[model samples]
Target: MTPITEVEGRRLALSNLDKVLYPATGTTKGEVLHYYAATAAGALLAHLRNRPVSFLRYPDGPDGQRFFTKNPPPGTPSWVRTTAVPHHEDKQARQVVVQDLASLMWAANLVVEFHTPQWQADAPGIADRMVFDLDPGAPATVVECCAVALWLRERLAADGLLAYGKTSGSKGLHLLVPLEPTPADRVSAYAKGLAVEAEQELAELVVRRMTRALRPGKVFVDFSQNAAAKTTATPYTLRARPEPTVSAPVTWAEIDECRAPGKLVFLAGDMGARLKRYGDLLGPLIDPDRAGRLPSAR
Candidate 1:
């Protein structure tokens, strides 16, 4: 492979990224656009401290907090902008973590806020932290994705699963479930169980977009990824999506009205348009009493 230096990388990258991000009026300069991903890597290091990063597209070390745009191993090529990672900036895991929303917004400087994973020293957070992943295979608008998020919230809530939503940047919504803070493996197990079961239940609502699909329509109750080893792109982590929007958090009230997916809920320019009018409907879903969470969710 050809070796691209940081400067060249940025230059080559901007050619592709500008078409997507459009950057704000004064946020980024054309010269540094390509190296933008690397710059965010530095910011992530400052935030995560001890977390291990997965879902890389390029070559990087284990526990690497890196991002590159090439073919990712196996499926490779993240199907988005980034192709790989060198490593997360801080490898020590300074805190109990769960990444989501606006965490990877380079323009936002990857300055994301998160609810600390709540669980015991040996427990996983998803048993209590409920999540629903709404992935659309077909082209989608930001609005449609949020609609799917709310739809899943209602469905999961009916099924006795507490559901909270977050943007995945690429064209999906992640519903998080807080477990008791156990091993990574256990959380993955619970997520898998939930995903499989959700797919089965959603079979009726799915539209036939593809034959022999993982259930059709724009949504897939994607619980299968909740394995100890399987990590969703924690909120704010850049997705390889075109234009590369960041997965961001929105109050239940802000779900609507917010046209752009990368905008922040805490302080986005237009908070009124979001579903914030409903208050944080998804918040209680994380509570054990409301969710009736179990020890063995998997």
Candidate 2:
């Protein structure tokens, strides 16, 4: 495979990716992986939206010592885990490779994800999982994400779109939808339209809608970055910053009640408990029935 990046001390291993690294959060013990995965989901999504499909690698934590890569490797961090998962299904890989992809979101406090050229896969199919990224210059939580999700769901359902919800493993709730026959581009256009519609409807509530808005605290609905050519960072991707950090996956239910920066939901302690009992809400997102847009791949 092609090398993603290189860093000190880290050796990229394509085999153990699944066992070691996750979407947003970086390498960790099997016990605490999910929490990081959830926390970093949003960041992963955002990152993908910005960049192309490439494996990202970095050290661990608020201050990691080295970086990692996503290829067969000339040299990568020894601690780097290569068993990463793509965000979506695709001709090359999954459409949305949700694992290690970016440094950190450009935003102050957001766990973004990555998007690939084929935002929607070509062959088979999956659900239309989406992340409603809200720019709350100030601090934000699950409540805000859910409130937005509810509004979006209501708005979407009105248009005959049935959607589901989940935590981005971080700051926002990803509201997935089930679209029939709509192409990925159409989905992107639809989402953008929805964002514009939301902005218009909630003009009073939204501090700003367009990228141009009040500095620092304006909440904007990012729909412009929905094109398949445009990519969002998948979860577990490393941040380009000095310290090796990845977005941690979070839960929608936990978002409203909890507001701890890296407080932890998955990898908090139990894996089976969370996986078995706390299923990933984004499941429907990749479902062809729900997240799948019509056969519109280029």
Candidate 3:
């Protein structure tokens, strides 16, 4: 049976609160909900505001069945706001917008372990940021990705674009640069160009090719995530891995020190303290005046 709780004057039905979502750590659904509600007023909610979010829900815990849910489930509270966004090019789907703490808590009740939000907010089909998902192939470690990320940072800085980095919370790192809301096509082109340049500079360490056969032991610079409707895990969201790891924002110095796997792992409980230290290093990316237009990647 589930228990009902009132959050922000709205009733929320929480189920399986005691169920262990992370088998290795024995983390419970209750802890997950508490983390979101606790972080809602700070770094987490600031990035989520007005963005259409897709949840990766694990109904039977992280080890069991999971599904990607974009639309709010049937019987969602009227107070839980949603925005109509295009899906599959045929029609529109209503995606939840985490506008308040209550809504954040509501999603946690559904056992959502991963928060994947579209790149664009408020303006659909237009992207406000360009992201490069640096995925390291097996036998290749996070250390290799860190080196490439540092290189990418230098390259972007030379071009006058600011880049921010965060762990993917699963097995890789993501580097993002804010851009003046440009057409998704243009954003994709700019990202691909940058990826190609990186590949040329570090031919052995980075691979622009997406073919699996060629990716072994190389860091894949995935520029394709810049497309419209494509989503990346939101910062501070927990991954449904064997352990309850979080997609944590990090400093360049920290990335340089990340010599091995599990060294940079951030659990849900560590988020508050991270907020205290980092104070949202990515916040300036969202500032209208701070984000600049993409320079020709040619």
Candidate 4:
């Protein structure tokens, strides 16, 4: 494999391309780099544009030590666009924003298996979407989380909002509801209220508590992920798991199909085919004109 990949006139250094990352599938670092590069013009880049990314870098592969990287490391190129997002009222932090294929490939070279982005960006304080992270605890399967996601989708629809569902590419599902430009605080509060309501109606299936001990046998409606600086896996990201699975966007009809175990487990190589079929179900979220707002908390 070449040491430097010329992506759109940018000579990004790509090392150890032949090294295997996913031991189970024998997926090489080169394959991972190509996966993001090939998908850049479609779902991956569209969703990641302008968002500050927190990369889950696994330099020694998935089995080795791993850590989160927000700031650009020693060799980040000047051409890679970035912005200083507000971390707190008194402090700000610079974050990588992948606007081009070279930036995406550069991250891939670092073995950034997962891409997590803040809901709101520094250039725009207004939130892009409100997320309800549906995490299924022990004894509870992704199937249960799917049920809860469908329920949330129904309620959001009742309130004149459209909610999109996707596999977290991990152990659960994530329901993302796109919002017009709104205050981040208000978005967080609204998501919390929505989760509380879901828990109230479906007491058996949903739990809003953050306590891990109390989460057993139930899907936790994690509203806390909507806050500023908090990040969720970007759609089409490759997750670090035994199987080289990806965070995949799905349609309402496909959600039911996902209930079957492993049906929605999208692998890195399977991305292009899926994109050809679905064409980005979450694309509507980027539309600024989508009419959706949180009703006052009850």
Best by lDDT: 3
How do these models rank on TM-score, best leading?
3, 4, 2, 1
User: Per-candidate TM vs. native?
Assistant: 0.47, 0.54, 0.95, 0.94
In model 3, the Cα lDDT at residue 105 comes to 82
lDDT of 3 by residue, 181-258 (tens): 888889888788889999999999999989999898999999988888688888888888888788889898989888
Relative to the true structure, candidate 3 reaches a TM of 0.95
In candidate 3, which residue ranges exceed 4 Å CA deviation?
87-89, 114-118
* lDDT at position 287, candidate 2: 54
Candidate 1 to truth, TM = 0.47
For residues 1-298, what per-residue lDDT tens digits would candidate 4 score against the true structure?
A: 5586688898877888888888899988888877887763567888888888888887777788989878777778888887877565535667788887777787778887545443546535567688888998988888888888888888889888899988898888988888776777888888888889999999999899989988999999998777776788888888888777888887777777565657767788777887888789888888877748777666
Clashes of each: 73, 103, 0, 0
Write model 2 residue lDDT over 1-298, tens digit each, in one string. 4223322332322222233333344444332333333444343344343223443333233343333233323432333233333444433432123234232211111221222433333322221344455544444444444555567767876666665554444444344454554445666766777787776776644433454545233345665444544434444443443223333344545554454534433333343354456454444444555543333233
lDDT of each: 0.40, 0.42, 0.83, 0.80
Question: What are the root-mean-square deviations of the candidates from the true structure over C-alphas?
Answer: 10.8, 10.0, 1.7, 1.9
Best by TM-score: 3
Q: Which stretches in model 2 have alpha-carbon errors above 4 Å?
A: 1-53, 60-131, 139-142, 207-218, 233-271, 291-298
